[model samples]
Target: MRLRAVRISRSPLLPLFLLISTALALWPAAPSTARPASCEPSVPYESGTDGYHTFRIPAALQVPDGPLLAFAEGRRDSAADDGDIDLVLRRSLDGGCTWQPLHVVADAGEDTVGNPAPVIDPDSGDVVLVTCRTIGGATKRQVVAGAVAGSVRRVYVQRSTDDGLSWSPQRDITASVKAADWRWYAVGPGHAVALRHGPHRGRLLVPANHSAGPTARSGAHSIVSDDGGLTWRVGYLSPGGDEPLALNESTLTELPDGRVYINSRDHDRTTEGSRADAYSADGGLSLSVPFRPQPMIEGPVVQGSVLQVRGLTGDEPLLYSGPSDPGERFRMRVRASGDGGLSWRPVWTVSEDRAGYSDLVQTGGGTVGLLYETGQRTYHDTIRFTRLPWVWRLLPELTVSQGEVSGSAR
Candidate 1:
């Protein structure tokens, strides 16, 4: 699938220029030398029920003890009730080469559970997992069927101190929202990221979007907790405006310079296009108006994730992965950004022939690892991994360096 280009009006360039200038001025200065390649490939882990299908959605989190945790949703069949959706998790201890057995972190009984987002809190050093659950089935008649089936959706939080070995009881974080809107369908948290530095260091910021009720318009909201995940303050990114143009699967990345950037699916794009980008000056408390779209190699879809490479050259390349469809076929492709997200270069294809979500992490040895779903014609999508050397993109530059520098210089 090909991403359509967004029109850039000459009027907005001045403000954008000033914003970029201010951001750069506040950024910490670093050595003029470019970052060395730090990503390498490793083996992937795979696991799931034999017959029932599973899909790894959103992004995956890398914990301290070497295990990578991914939140996956499973489906018995398409005919099954929508309320049957459940959240399952898998881990890869030895990089991504192999995976552990399926662990049902949250399951749908009379309620629905999906959209699992995992993050490792630096302050507590614990892995926190959040997912949205709907109490009632999602059908026209179900809304009129009964109070139980038409209940609202909510966001639940769980933490794992010892990697993915165990988890705390699910805690509710949707009490501040409207009761009916917080029902099973539209109420709940989306993706979250912890502050890496500064006074609010270690606090968690979760992006909650509107998904409850039939007539609700989706907007971006956030919850902040000063004491790790113990307490939260809820508010909207853009107060009293049409919900900021965004969808469910969004990502937050803290740059080396201390600014937090958010990339979200642009549901407001009327024509075909790729994802949209936003920024948070006050550590995700609020976001600027959505920026113009970037040209993505893949066509537009609702969910994707983007991560900033800590030590990369040419504008700190960002890795983005999401579903790309061209007509009837669906595939997953990864793209690289040289000048941030203003432009992109195609990197690799995670899945050339399947339907799933993917996550990327920079390993200790400077390799980039990807966790995604595999298995065609099967309902259960097992986690698959692939590693690429950090030097993959730098190979061309290295070749020139070898010709210019002598052995004594090395």
Candidate 2:
């Protein structure tokens, strides 16, 4: 796949400083050094060739080996080709202290590989990688001037039996199902979560979307596979509302009470650009009509990720990490929830510098690992990693089990 250089226009709501300031005022003040740990940000070692650069997005996973596996989209300098945006993987073995190198997992054959969502299947211990592939580059014209291009963009899934070392052949998901229009790009197998401890246990649920095309409405869709992504059944969620609620980049977690909660990115919401909340039940297959949005400390509207942390004392707490757009600058925020997703307590700031499109994973030792783009700008940025103590972002209800130490050095 060739890499295409499309200049994505800045969001119309680019001046977000006032919005961020207002949101910050609503947020609770930072506590006076409560839970401390080694809090040093490490620069990610860039992998891949010089000509081929990879930009990390909001997709990553953590394995028991202490390495945080991340997927990035690689591309060349030119904007003519979209096929060069291949999917590559990297690992941070020393607990996000340092990263190894980039491992090319999947390369798009004359297509663009993007929106990688990685998850670890508890039952099989296999790393499941799902990404979107654009066969001809549907949105290239939107990026480039006077360029009329179209492609068959479909989501594909690959499994790695040996952690991030090897992967199986890519399988196209929407092969049988007919799309609404040829100009429509159906991307994202967003975040795949294997149901744990419930009637839907062992099932893998993937959220996808068909962007607005020449003929169809852009809305959210979901696919479920009982047998670990080999076969899937497509379905719609929260459809036929007053306005189009295009849900994408969803994060799913099974609560301790056997309830499945999905926090999705709402593109067409009224207030929040990045809206999140819980779905009805049954892994988003049967969702409640007109889902309500959760009240997050407002910032720039961008995609985020969530993880359920099992405390040392067997307490299950939730952690959410995302880029908070403050109008002018973007920062990463970490929030905690003790009672599911109903309420949240603000935690430490993940990135003091500019950041965008973040993903989070809870390490086996209870540490939270973050993969996010760190730079002043949005698309063209560097991916950085950082780890915080499980209690770094403390909630009033939860106790700090581990001692806090300042990891000030990178």
Candidate 3:
């Protein structure tokens, strides 16, 4: 898509048009140059192009320095799940216009490390990344069933003090966050949010998923840090039930009442294409409302993202991104909500072709940035970054013409 340049009139004296016409006749009009294009995408990672066979599970965060850091899993062998996977990142200083070279944040020889969940601390201006790792040979199915020999899934935390230019060594936090019965665990495949209002103003909440069952299934949860990234503790884990009741891979947004609104991926076949949502009142210690479907959001049980854009005084409109079609992962679209997340309206369609697993964030300039997985055929073909205009730019334009405009065109 091409972006049209905006035209602006610099002359303020419209009534003095006769006087300005004398000067305009002497000085020819200056040549017009196009403003930089918007909504253009840059590929941060592509399979087979960067030595890795695949790059999946993207997470993005814009640090205080104004550079966007995009995280993904670099799979070395093939598009399959279990392999020599490492956590990698790409940096973009000028919104999403250009990208820096690949930077591997965490690599463990032939081991698997992925699912980057990053949150920036408002007070300290530091960024923390929480991820999961496992042995190279172990698959998620084997880990979920507890068929593996020893502890399979482990959690780790790392920090970046210099605006994602460098990172500290990984520290294991499995014992503090994971239960003994849980086998399959994963941090968010998206970015986490920090609270800005009410009692839990500075709390950092990271959305996550785990599997702990007599029947062995998956459920969604959160891990939070109050005193910054120095420490972390377990929050709430969703209660599991019969078939079509399992929830996983969640995204979070802070409500006006200091509660967290979670939108989760449903694993049960009964619900099929819909997502389940819940709320945490006690700062994610437990759920105030259990997981249930909202008819407004129709997704194919895939991971989606929610972002709360803050206004000058308080919470503003909330944004959500996912596939518009309930049956397939196509028509990647974004929606907006005025009353938190109760109702939604389609803001824009990011892509009509194949797309999956997107994370959204408001950039420093107030424009929205989307880092997601998209391709022509498969989901893991490439990781891309897309920028969107603010709400004012998307308002409907009223044009008067001699011919009647159809309602469908409007």
Candidate 4:
């Protein structure tokens, strides 16, 4: 077959379109740091959904990398502290927009494992977690009273090298870290801090609480690891027994000046009833000042979380999350401090509904991530993760359910 060839002048629009396409291809894309607008508060774990009766005591740590490692206690049988409870973890690589499947950190077949206190070693980049293992289902009161005969609380350490993807076997360090005379001990239900500014910089400090004997009061203390979590020792023990306030479920933060600041839950409900605090300059080996009541804040003797918002220092801009209600365990509120912790201003009410234990961690892009227990009808029904940005300071108070909840977990 014969064919004819035809030629014509290229249109000016063709060159313009080519130029635009080339420019578009060469231009660098903007990083998607902004959370999805459709994201809403979501329950990562819920009771009766995961075969566990309930979940409680949240602890989250933003690893040296960009992901968040959230730890919780999965009660296999019931919501009570005793029984087949497991220390479980869920990871979020996208600043807590979504979380990975539940990963069991340490599971004792018939015993209980809980109170996850995690700290990242800045030098070695290891996520070290310390948890208490009770041989039998025993409540803190029972343990403190020495009623659970032949059953005792012990401490174990687990390390995650790949940013919390997996954890090592639990290493028993109770003998070195706990006093043999002590009857009950629990690690932080919140994230632990590492010293960065003081002479003891790079030290890993795990905030903890313990009772001396069967009838003794509980006080706050910290476990310290200097050589990147290879070994741990009892660092500082707060003075004054448990008279003024029974310190329990404590949280820690390293000040810019190198002093370790402790925020504790006070069990004494009569006179000096408030959150307790103390400071230590010796890298937690000893509290230079004893723990005292924090009169400015009030709660129903619940575990709280304290975190230093990234890039904001000098004691100002510290963030605290807990149940703000004095008489009830409702209203999960986030308060901001302008003068270290002397005074606080409510930034947002995470949930005006039923709420319980909570944890706070600053994301890679500087937004705050909170993992807490809240439910539609009860406090222990579900555990949700919420992201709060700095802009919340200007807008009217917002709750997690009102804000966007992203389901995209990468």
User: Considering TM-score, where higher is better, how would the candidates rank from best to worst?
Assistant: 4, 3, 2, 1
> What's each prediction's TM-score?
0.73, 0.77, 0.84, 0.84
Write down the lDDT of every candidate, Cα atoms only. Answer: 0.55, 0.60, 0.75, 0.75
TM-score, candidate number 1: 0.73
Which scores higher on lDDT, 2 or 4? 4
Candidate 1, number of clashes: 29
Off by over 4 Å in 1: 1-51, 56-58, 77-81, 138-151, 177-191, 211-215, 235-246, 289-291, 311-316, 325-329, 374-382, 392-410
- Sliding window of 10 residues with minimal summed lDDT for model 3: 398-407
Local error of candidate 3 at 264, Å? 0.3
- lDDT for 201 in candidate 2 is 79
Task: Give lDDT: candidate 3, residue 236.
Answer: 82
Which has the better TM-score: candidate 1, or candidate 4? 4
Clashes of 3: 0
Q: List RMSD in Å for every model shown.
A: 10.5, 10.6, 8.8, 12.7
